[model samples]
Structures are given as structure tokens and as C-alpha cells.
Target: MIALLSALLQGCALPSLEGRSESHALKRAETADTALGRALMPQAQARPGLSGILPLADARDAFAARVLLVRAAERTLDVQYYIWREDITGNLLLDALSEAAERGVRVRLLLDDNGVSMDAKLLALDRHPAIEVRLFNPFSVRRPKALGYLTHFSRANRRMHNKALIADGQAAIMGGRNVGDEYFGATDGVLFADLDVLATGAVLPELSADFDRYWASASAYPIDRIVAPEGTAPAPVPHAEDDPRAARYLQALRESRFVADLLAGGHLPQWARVDMVSDDPRKGLGLAEKEDLLTHQLQQVLARPPVASLDLVSPYFVPTAAGVDVFSRLAARGVRVRILTNALEATDVSAVHSGYARYRKDLLRAGVELHEMRRGAQPQGGGAGVFGSSGSSLHAKTFAIDGQRVFVGSMNFDPRSAHLNTELGFIIDSPVLAQAVTQAFDRDIPASAYEVKLDEGGGLVWTERRDGQTLRHKREPGSTLVRSVWIGLLSVLPIEWLL
Candidate 1:
């Protein structure tokens, strides 16, 4: 396995390290974080900015703000991702990062080493002096080709499944969206199950602290350390400057008719009140090093007496036996618990559903409301064609309790997010925000999902609420067969934690 990892990483060479002039961007970045500092801190305000649950059905508004933040950055910019394709969206982001670095901004980019196979433009970014990139838990191969045949047990089961961008130590965007078109709903004939949170306040400091911790961790390797002296090693890419259309992928994206429709959709609803919390400092807020804050907090909340209603939306739901016990206890307390997760066929990760399938009966016995997003919904734009026909999946992760509190972040409802990978999100203690999120859930639940009900034969059947249609299979006509085959094959792979 070590041999395989080494080959993959070596073939997907990182940028060579050359000393670059240091700029004063760090100081400016510090000040920016401080300017937005007070609001993120819990002691300063009950909520920051306008905190409301919003339905982000498109990419324009959020993407525009993201670009602006990257452009406005004056000092340090830290970005981490599980995937960063060399597509239009990826190029746009890299351009912004390059612009920031050219202005003397200290930029650090972290990406999962496993995804190097899909990266075609990673080496080019290394030429910039102000930018430093690292791969998390990189494989050990010194050569390329045939590395896939080797599979080591170590790190082979671990992954850095986090999505975060910290600029000037104050503002951050954290959630499910990665550096991919599908993630932002900008891909052709595809829409993803994803969510993200943008914040400018005290929470920025906490996120920065985590970024610094991870940046300095043993798992990270500076780009300079990975690349050999210029003339010493074989070139990974024959020509860097010769790649004339490196950023042309975005143009293809523009050609997609659905892309325009999604752009026309309105922006995410801004919250009038937002509350931010980091897991207690003693535990590093349950980031990478410990139990995930999302899972730990969810466990704690479940321990309490039941509330009248609890609504949950998670794309990946893999409940363990103990977890089911906790939820069952809540039901015993009279709390009307309801949940929405990707159905078996609608899921992008079938192994997660496999784990979840083991506990479904237990959850149903405990009286939890369960629903799964359907294959189609009114496209973000007015009408739908291939975009609607694609068997889209659920990607949002959220929880609402008694319409009083809401949690949003990059964390998923799986063992990786709960006990392995580093994750982050916001916990708002506002009835108004909770109500908005809950209302959005109510509307979303009815149209795009099906409620799971127990039939007379003691089996589960899906019921579409819109037209009262009932179906057993999750696959719908025109679904992406490639995705189905991919998920099926990946689900059988033993190393789910690594994925």
C-alpha cells in the first residue's frame, strides 16, 4: 500500500519549493480578522449579522461573494479542500489566489493527497512565490505508474475531508462545497447535495487557529520539500506555459444552459441573527484531533429530554447501534424526531448507506421521521431538462430542535466526521433562524423527497408526496448510470474511511 501511495503522489508531483520574497500581507490579514472579530465571539453578541436559514439553489451570489473575499484579501489566505479540479471554477479560484499572492498575500493551500489523480494543474500554482501548497497524508511512492495496485493500511483509511477558506484571519466559508462544478451546481447535467456557511466574526479566529494547527501538523509537507531540484527529476508535465487553455474549462461551463438558469436564481437568504460556537477550547472544538464537534454536540443534545419536534437533514446518514439507542431514548421521551437522508439509490456514497441500513430498523422502531430526496425537482432555474433528469442527491447537513437552535457546517453524519476527520460548522441559538430553516425544510421535504413509511408487510416503501406516487427502487429514468456504477463499485471497496 505504501508503494501505491508513493507512486500516486510522485506521479502527481507538487510544486518545487523556491524561496520567495515575503510581503506585509500577513499584518493586513491580521487586522481584517480583528475587524470582524467581536461578532464571532459568543461574549460579544447573541448573533452576528443576519442569521437565517437560507436555500442556496444557485451559484452566482455565493460564488460572487467568494470571489470578492478572495480578491479583497490583503494578507494571509488559507484554503483547504478535498477536491480541486482544473475546471473553470477551480481556475477562477486559483486566479484569485494568484492575484492575492501577487499583492504580497501569504497564501497556503491544503488538499487531500488522494485526489492528486484528478488534478491536472496543481504543479503550475507552485511557480508563484507567495503561494505554498501541501498535500495531507501524502502517499510515499517515489516513482509513478502502477501505484494503484499497491494499497497500504495506514492513511489508506484516513482522509482530510474538510472544506474551509480563511482570509485575513477573520472571514471564512465552511461547508460541503468543494472545488468542483457539481458542488456549486455549475456542472453540466448535474447538481450536488451540498451546503456551505459564510461567516465574518469571532468564529474566524477559531477557524484560523485550527488552520494554523493543521498547517503545522506532522501530516503536512511544504511544496518545496516534495519537488526535486529543477534539472534533477523528470518533468511531471511536459509544458506549463504551453498549456494555452489551462483555464478554458470554465468556458464549457458557461455553455451549459442550466448554468445560466442557476445564475438567475436569487442569492442565499441572509440571517438577521447568527450565533457562532467553537467546541470548548479544551478539546480544540472537536476538530481533526478529537471527536467531531458536530457529532459530539449531537450526542449531547440527544442525551437531553425530548422536545416536541426535531428535524434533521443529512446527505450521508450512517447511524451506529449506540447512536440508534440514543435516538430511541429521545423518542421514549416523547420527542417527535424526524430525519431526511439520501435514499439508497439517491446516495453518492453507497457504503455510508450500507452502514446506515444496519440501523434503519432500529431508528424506525424508535419512531424517527425519515425521508430521502428524490431524483428530480424544479431545477434552480424556471424549467428543467437534463438538469432535472439527472438523479441528483442530497448534500445538505443540518439539524433543528424545537425551532430554537440550528447547526450548519461541513460536517457529515458519518463516522469519519464524527470521530476521524476535522470538521466545522455554526450553532445558532435563535428561534427565528430555526423557524426559517425548519420552514425551508418543510417546503423542501414535500416537493423533492419521499417519506419512508412502514407497510403492512413490515418493510419500508417510499411515497412521493407531490402526486402520491409510490415506488420501491430509488433509480429514476434518465439517472446517471455512470454515477450508479461508480457508487456501486466504490461501496464494495473496503477503504471507505479513506474516501
Candidate 2:
């Protein structure tokens, strides 16, 4: 490992995107999105400042919104994400971007390096003249992949956890879901109950500016420069959908009814004011020494230290001592705090669950209502979530404050989001949205979650409703003994900060 690390250090240094920085004022009607951009401007201008906020509760709506936005964009598309897997979902999105590029729509894709493993699809996508791919705080090693991480673990540990898709500088989608099947609810195994917002009013420019800052920042490394044996960006050429892999992706895109719905533009609303919030990308590189986090900014925007209720839904919930204290104080003040997170059976990452389980008892003792999402929790109507399959885990990082505010973003209620990852989200002061999200929270508590309570003996009891039948378990659901052992062993490890 030492030799490999040494070799990586001796390898090519991180490349530069120096001359690539170009600033252009956001021209609304003048841009290529003339068809759609022009039509929305008049109506968008009339609505307060920036409204038209719609919650993408359904995974199909979220994915389709992105695809439609890409298709509708005629001027430019700025897409940024923490994880952009080279999976079925990823390829289909890429194919759509390619078609948009073919039409001369300039597409900028800014992805976190830590979230991506260097591969052929990324290289191929980066080659498009109309498409530009930039990696935030990229790794140096090109040959022995893992060596780069080991050598620069400190720097690589911090990641850009922001996810947004902006088109024509007029519309955007920002939230917890990354570019993958699981996020889209297409994964055959476990599906994440994620949240995203489809907004098309005044918030787009704010998102665009943030995208440019990271794109031109010192950290953004062009993909061509990161991979060694530097290859030329592939020239604009014929569609590669002839390849079997490419065909599969294109086929999914073609058959999706969401494609038609989004193109019609009648699904989402077109009015309301939304405050756009994002952490500077420098936060990921530790250069934001004096900078406040997006979370802090969100707190200020929320303007409520102590509220009547706090409904939080986070997949990876590791409330450290500080978090516990916050919840404990809220509970003391008669504030109802309801939290929903993945159970041992549903979590994709065991370490996160281990870290979170440590605080379950603490929270319950403090009067904070805690619900661990069951592996097969379904809506009361037995309606399947996006995955519409067996396993379902909570991935939506959102919280409703009081009954008038809601926050949905990539910021998980964990140390990684608060301290390490640069995150983004919207703290909309829409009571309508807040109520909807709050209702969802309340529904999940009974139908799709395990209400954790303490028995008279000071032990944990998980009460869950399955198939219209209520059941109680004294231990962790499914694999009780084995899961306990796994979480117990992992909880002892000193890695809470990573979670």
C-alpha cells in the first residue's frame, strides 16, 4: 500500500481547468430555450418573486422532470451531483443529455470525484463537444485507483454532497436523490424514499450561479485531465445507441410516460417564492475556514430555534451528542420531534445504522418520537413506493418545522453533512408544502415505520404494522441476533465522525 501510494504521489499531478472559466450573464428570453423560456418568463414574472414550487414525491416525477428539463433546454444545462453512477439510470440520463447536446444545447455536468469511480462511460460522456464534465476535488491516482484515496483520505473525506439539475437558467431540481436506479426507485432490491423539488420560476439563476462557482473554482478538474494517458474529447459524432448497452438506456427513456407528462408542462405548479440555499463548494476542500454551513444558513432562514413540532426524515441518522441535546431540549419545551430513519434490515450502509442506533435510546428517553423504517413498509393503501418492490428504506433528507416550513435537500442529519460534505437544499416557507410533508411524516410513523419505545424494563421495543396487522418485536426486526451483533460491534468502532 505504501509503495502504491508513493507511486501515485509520483504520478501526474491534479490537472487544471484554468482557461475554462467563462462568465456570462443569465439572459432569459435571448437564450436558445426561446420556445419554453420565453413562455414561462411572463407568467413567472407575475408570481411574487420566485414561486412555482412543486414537491416531487414520486420517483417517476423526479426522474421525468430532469429528463424533460434536459429536453426542453435549448440554451444551456447545468447538472451537478455528488454521485453519478454509470448504471442503467445514469446511462439513460447521459443519452438524453447527448441528444440535447446534438441540438447545440451546451450541457455542463459537475460531479463529485469521490462519488464516481473513473470509468469508460464518464470518459465517453466528457468527450462530447457540447457536454463538459468537471469533477470536484478530484483524486490524483489514475492507475491504482484505491491508492489515491488512502494517500489523500483527509482531503477526499470531504465531499460535495449537492445534487441539482438546472436547465436554460430558468428551472431546476434539487434534493437528496443522486443519479442511480436506487434513487429513481428502479433498483430491484432496496429503494430509497427520496425527495426532490421541481421548480421553474426565479430560483434557477441562483442555482446556475452556484454551479458556475464550482465549475470555475480551483477544485473543479476537467475529466480529460484527471484520467492519465490524456485522451482528446471525442468529436461530436453519430449516436452510439447502436451498442446494446446504449440501446437499453435509450429504450427506457423512449418508453417512459414521464417523458410525455413533463413535456406537456401541466403537472407542476407555476407560482410562489422560494429561498435558494447552497454551501460554497470550498466547504468540501476545507477552504471555507470562516464560512458558515448551508445548514446554519438554513437555520437562520427557518428563524425558529424552538418550535411546536419538528418532523425529520433522514436515511442515515447518527445524532451525535449535540444533536441529542437539541432534540432533548426541544422535547423538554413540549415540542414534538418525530424522526424516521432506516432500520437494520433496510439500511444500505451498516456503519451508518450502527452509529445511529447508539442514540435511539437516548432520543426515546428524551420524549423524542423515533420511528425506524421497516424493510417492507408500504402506504396504507398498500401502494408501493418508487421501487414498488420488497425492500424500502428512507433516503429523503427533509424536515418540517412547526406547520409552516419544510426543508428538503441532500443534507442528512449526520456529522458528514454538517461538518464534511458541502450540501444544498430549499427552506421554503410554504405552509402548503410544509403540511404535505408533515402529513407524509405522520403517515409513515404508523403504516411504514417501527415506533421505537421503551418497555418497563428500559429496553427497546419496536412496534410495526404490516399487512394490516400490528406486530411487536423486542429486538431488531428481521435478523435480530445477527443484526444486534453487527451493530454492536460496529458501534464500538471510532468512526461516528465519518457517518
Candidate 3:
């Protein structure tokens, strides 16, 4: 049994690729002439410009933005993500992509293989004449999740967490939000406070190159080759009939403030000076460390010789000992560090919160400000506005430096992002972009988050304001006795690294 367990845990090589023809972006060598391209390409030739979009904080606008981009892109669309659900948002996007393909526009979709259950939907789309799908580091066993994980734990655990949607190689949407009901605020119980940036120009080249590198890597296998052979159906894509819910949702999207303003057509184009930063393709396999990871690049960028202040927002923040040391050094050097993360009741992953609970004191001792998002509030009249219809949780992985630099991407500040998965995002050197993100941090922190302070006796106390009243909690807010016990129990486990 021991020997079998050892073998099961041993890392395995990625699946062998079949003889698949190379399919590059639609406007590979030339420029895109679509609506997006015509609007941005000329200025892009001059320099990269980024427009920080905040309406996504409200879920309706989030999905609306993606839909509008799909509708406007005439030449090509490239999508890469970690999760693509088959729910309202996911199905809507898929149907849109299919329609775009049927219109003679080329489409490329890439997804990570772990926990992928939308095989039929993905496989059907893969068969589209103008669409192709690939899986990053797929499993040999298509079903029975446990057996596949046990057989290939080391390989399957490392995933591609990058999220981006590029149109015509002229502009792209890059950020931390994934394609799911919850992410777009379509989910009823919770809404994720996330971030994304719409960009065009100089960064588009690097972003496209990055996508091609991973698409051509040995780790990326053609979806049809792997999924269809495992007794799964793969039929040619057909025309997508209108979904009634999708129709109603589309109508609502057109009426959204963000899109309505866009349709009014008087607003000029918004752009920013930007730099595209990411990890090497080899980082996808965990073979490379700091030298190739995006974190290392960030460290280098900050090392010359650091910014005046930093604002960090991550849903899962388990800063390891080394991370603690880094933040401590930054604080000692007079960098005002403020961090916001999900509180106990607001977090989707209790285990990660357990890992973070241990670091609260360390952060406070180092003079770093700590804030936690409160449990989600009830949906106000089933509101679909920017803050989300239901309660809120921070899913945006972003950092601001001295209110002049901003980064929004899939990488978290935890060990998993640092050492395990491949990540992607861009850092912009625009004060306008930075200020936008900073303003968001300042606005949301005091309104929906609990500010944590070290009591004179070294205990933690949380304070917040709600409904014209100041609320204080000596224990974790919303934590029941059983919850407190479980949190304590989880904190003692030796699983901090995984969080």
C-alpha cells in the first residue's frame, strides 16, 4: 500500500499531443480592422493605453461587457480561463461565441482541465468550423474525479489560472474574474467583488504572444482528441437558438448604465500607458520558481527601490512566513501597507481563512493595516447593480503602488499563486488607473469591511459602521461557537502552504 501510494503521488508527464494543425490568431501578422481594432490600433501603435473598468463590481455590467465585446469583434476572439460553468452566464457566453464563429469569425478557447464538467458543451463548441478548444494539462481519466487526482496529483494540481479575453489582437480584457454565475453576479446567494481592465495597443502583442506560447506547449491538448475518445459525445456545433433567459438578460444588459452610456456614443476612447507582465510558459509546470514567476517580476519592479505605499486586495490571503517577512520589511521602510481580504463568514474557503487568521497579529505588529470584508448583504430588490445583487466577497487580486501603478490579475498573494499555478496580468504605469483602483479601495474598505486593530492586550478587535451605527465585535463577527471551534481546529493543521 505504501509503495502504491508513493507511485500515485509521483509527478507524471503531461499527455502526449496528437497531430493537430497549428491555428494562430485570426489576424496573426497583420492588424485587426474590426470596430475594436479600428478604434484602438492606431493609438496602440503609438503606445499602450488601459481603461480601468469598475462597473464589473456590479455583476450585470460584468457579463454585459463581455457580451458587447463579443458582439463587436469582427475578426477574432481568444479566451483563456480556469473555470467556465454551464449556467446562465457560461451558457450565454458559449452561445455568443458559437454565433460569432458562425459569422466567419475565428475563435480560440483554452481552459484548465481540473474540475471541468462541461464536456458536452465544450466538446460541441470544439467541433465548430471556426472554433477550436484546448485543455491545459488535462487528466487521462475523464471522470471519477478522485481516481484521476490520486493517479496524477502532482501534475493535476498545477493549473493555468490565467484569465483573459482578447479580440482581434488589438484589445483585450484581463483580470481575475472567471466565467461563472457567481463571478458575474448571476448567482443568487453571493456576488464576488472582482476587477478587470480593458486594454488596447502595446500590451496586446505581448498578451497574444503569451497566449500562443501556452497554446502550443505540450501541456495543452486538443479538447476533441482527449474528451471525445472517452465515450463522450462530440457533435458538430449547430446554430444557437435564442434562450429566453438570455434574451431577457440581453435586454437588461443593453439597459445597464455602463452599456447604455457606451451606446450613447459620445464618450471618447479611454486608454493608458501600460506594460504587460507575466510568467514564462515553463512556469505552468512548476519547474521554474521566482526567476520566472510573475511574483518575481513584481518584486523586481518594486525593488527599484519600492513605492511609497501599497494597497492589496485578495480574496484568499495566507501570506506565508516569507510573505510576512516581505511585508514587514516594506512596513519598516515606511511603506504604508493596507490589505483587504474576506472575513471568516464571508470567505468561500474556510481553510484559507484559517491560514490567514494566524497572520493577523503579525501584520498588525508590522504596522500593516488589516481589513476584512463582511458577510454579504441581502440582495436589495434582487438588485443587479455594481456592488452585486446579493452579499459581497473580494475576488479581485489587485495591488496599487503609491497611487501610480495598478495590477489586476489571477495571481493571489498566497503560496499557491507564488509556487504552484501559472498566472497572467499587466502592470500599468498610469496615475489615472492607479487612482481609480485606490479610490475603489478607499471607498469599499470603510463601507463593507471590518478594520482590525490589536487591542492593548494583544487580542484582535474588529470595528465597522453599518446603518448609521458603529458595530464592534470582540470575537470574529458572525462566528458561532461551533464555527469558532472549527476555525481553531483548522488553524493547528499543517496545511498552511496549500492555502
Q: Tell me model 2's lDDT, rounded to 2 decimals.
A: 0.77
Best by lDDT: 2
What's each prediction's TM-score?
Answer: 0.74, 0.91, 0.90
* Model 3 Cα lDDT, one tens digit per residue, 181-244: 7787665667787777666666677788889888887778888767654354555433223556
Alpha-carbon RMSD of each model: 6.9, 3.0, 3.4
Lowest summed lDDT window (length 10), candidate 1: 380-389
lDDT at 390, model 1: 30
What's the true lDDT of residue 113 in model 3?
Answer: 82
Sort the candidates on lDDT, descending order.
Answer: 2, 3, 1
Question: How would you order the candidates by TM-score, starting with the best?
Answer: 2, 3, 1
RMSD of 3: 3.4
The local distance difference test score of each candidate is 0.59, 0.77, 0.75
Who wins the TM-score comparison? Answer: 2
Model 3 ranges with Cα > 4 A deviation: 1-15, 26-29, 46-56, 229-244, 263-270, 305-307, 377-391
**Between candidates 1 and 2, the TM-score winner:** 2
Residue-level lDDT tens digits of model 2 in 234-300: 4332344555755664566567666576557656573656777777778877877444678768766
Question: Candidate 2, after superposition: displacement of residue 393 in Å?
Answer: 1.9
